[model samples]
Target: MSTITLNDGSPVPWLAFGTGTALYGKDASDFVKVAIENGITHLDGAQMYNNEETLAAGIKASGKPRSELYITTKLKILEPGQTATEALRVSLRKLDVDYVDLFLIHSPSPANKEGKLKALWEEMEEIHSQGLAKSIGVSNFRVEDLNVILEGAKVIPAVNQLHPYVWKAAQPIYELCKERGIVIASYGGQTPIVRAVGGPLDAVLPAIRERLEKTRGEPVTSGQVLGKWILQKGAILVTTTSKASRIKEFLDTKNVPDLTEEEVHVIEEAGEKLHKRIYMRHVFE
Candidate 1:
């Protein structure tokens, strides 16, 4: 698998098997093990997901060496008198690892609402310096929220994980992150297919898929077309599924022909026809 290099030079897998959404609040050991066994090396988890221990169990069951995997978890909630470092240490314990590849502020709401985003980010940087988290970033952060920390951030966020899709491309944040060297890690890349079934992309995806099938000389699905769209847009895709076939299909997206610039434009235009958000509605609102 190819990797996306961060500003700090840490290589992250382009496609990650995420333990969110469908796996949230659930024991994800089996799914994690299956993802690892099927060639996915990056595993995305979060303190908010409340399944890190079971996720660790699945990593153990996969029999893949810890060195062979890239693991990420987020800081969800900081308790009273609790520091970000302290919270991450607890997460490290649950993940059964000394350090994670990426650690993020789960959302800007907590610290931003409290007017402490800078302080929280300093703590995140401190943990990074202590070798607790390889890279630090934020999730569900908007331009205003990012500006809060970026104003005085010693370490600019390496990533901003968001629910970016055809319907909601998050172009403003995306452009800003790109300018600042922060990569966008996208969850819900397939939202249009699953959640907004009757949208404009319904008519658009099949024609694009047909063209891709001709180029790749194999069958293509609407999901792969969207996956290609996400990749071409230069964002990391974080996705999950319960089916083995689905996992393979997603993994195979890396092998498909890249989407044409026109195809990408068509999809984007179709997406603009209807706006929908499957998760983290607060981020958009």
Candidate 2:
């Protein structure tokens, strides 16, 4: 399996199965079962999604040993008077797992985004120390949010999940993550194509896809091209597909040759022309 070695030396698969808003509380188990059967072993979930039981059920249905799977979930909110540790314990009960391979603070605290970031991160560090979470990270966190955490952080986050598709490249934070050995788990790696269908990439991707298919001797897709771009940048991909065929297409990207550096530049350069942001909402809102 292709994996990225996190800061703590644990491995996370390059292709992750995601349980996002659309699948919350509905058929998460069924699709997760599909994902597992199709060779997906990493699951990305969250406490805010209200579907931990569904995800838990999916894992049970797959019958894959807990040790064989890499599971990740996040702390959705820090309610009034609730500590980060307390919030995670509630998630543990819902997930029915003693320890998540990766746990994250879902986002910067919206109410007082900067005021509490450092302290919340410290609390996350404590959860990691207790072995309740094997690794700790953050999601949808921008560069400014990170500056505060880094000030007094005893443990640097192992990963940072961000929406870095097309125009929303998140360069500053992306560079910061690399300099610090923080693995990036890209959630919208393929969203631009999904949203743009016949947009800018269509003009250039068909030829690149054709060239790559020749290189690998297998059918290559625009989705795969986008995935390959993310992969070539040495980032992990968080993607979801409810259909079996689509799941296979996602895994198939592994066999193809890496996109040339120029090709990657071309795609991003094209994306820069169509700057847009997705996944900008705070879950608490």
Candidate 3:
């Protein structure tokens, strides 16, 4: 798989293995090792996930050199007077890594009550300068939240990680990130199929799948069609699955035939028919 060059000049895999709520507090070493075995070099973790210890276990199990892995972790909710530097120091100890490929502000302060975005980002830049992190970015940030940081940020955020489900995708935010050279990482890569199980895509996805299967001379699943849609949109994908077979299916999306122009529009049009958002616990609210 090819890597997406970030604005900071760092490379991240187009597909990432996510240890979100699904693997929270579980021994993910086995899962992590499985992901690595299946060509998933990017592992996404977070302080809030509370699974870094096991995350480390998985990395160790993979037995790959640290240099070959692209690790991403995020700072938890910012407390008053908190700094990204100190936060990252704590995370480093937990992950047992001297440096991470990417780090991020987990979320904006509750309605930005503490008003620490400027202070946090300044320290984030400082952390990058110290070589603690290769790139710095944000998660769950709306356009208004980013505007506040853009006002004084010297280093443009390297990426923005959010749900970005097709139905509820905010096109303006995607375009905004594109303009700023901030790559988008989507955590909800399979949401279109998982949550909207029988939605409009069901009607058309099967036909698209048949066309792809015939062209590729292999089996095609609806999930791959959705994954291709997200991949074609230039957004990095972070998908989580405990099953090995499912992991292979997701990684194989790299080989799936590209969606036709008309097929792409069909997925988007179906998404607009019903907007379903799964992430609602926003600190920015």
Q: How large is the C-alpha RMSD of every model relative to the true structure?
A: 1.2, 2.0, 1.7
- Give the TM-scores of the predictions, in the order they appear: 0.97, 0.94, 0.94
For candidate 1, write residues 2-48 as lDDT tens digits. 98899899999999999989999999999999999998999999999
Worst 10 residues of 2 by lDDT: 276-285
Greater TM-score among 1 and 3 belongs to: 1
Candidate 3 Cα RMSD (Å) = 1.7
Supply candidate 1's per-residue lDDT for 121: 91
Local accuracy of candidate 2 as per-residue lDDT tens digits, 1-285 = 388899988899898999985686566999999899889999999987788888989999989999999999988777789998888888888878899999988888672454877888889899999999999998877777878787768999999887765344487888888888888888877766776565676788888999999988878988899888888777888988889898899888888888888898888777776645567555323
TM-score of 2: 0.94
List pairs with backbone clashes in candidate 1.
none
**Best-first order by TM-score:** 1, 2, 3
Would you list the C-alpha lDDT of every candidate in the order shown? 0.90, 0.83, 0.83
- Native-vs-model 3 lDDT? 0.83
Name the candidate, 1 or 2, with the larger TM-score value: 1
Q: Is candidate 1 or candidate 3 better by lDDT?
A: 1
- Model 2 ranges off by over 4 Å: 111-114, 166-169, 281-285
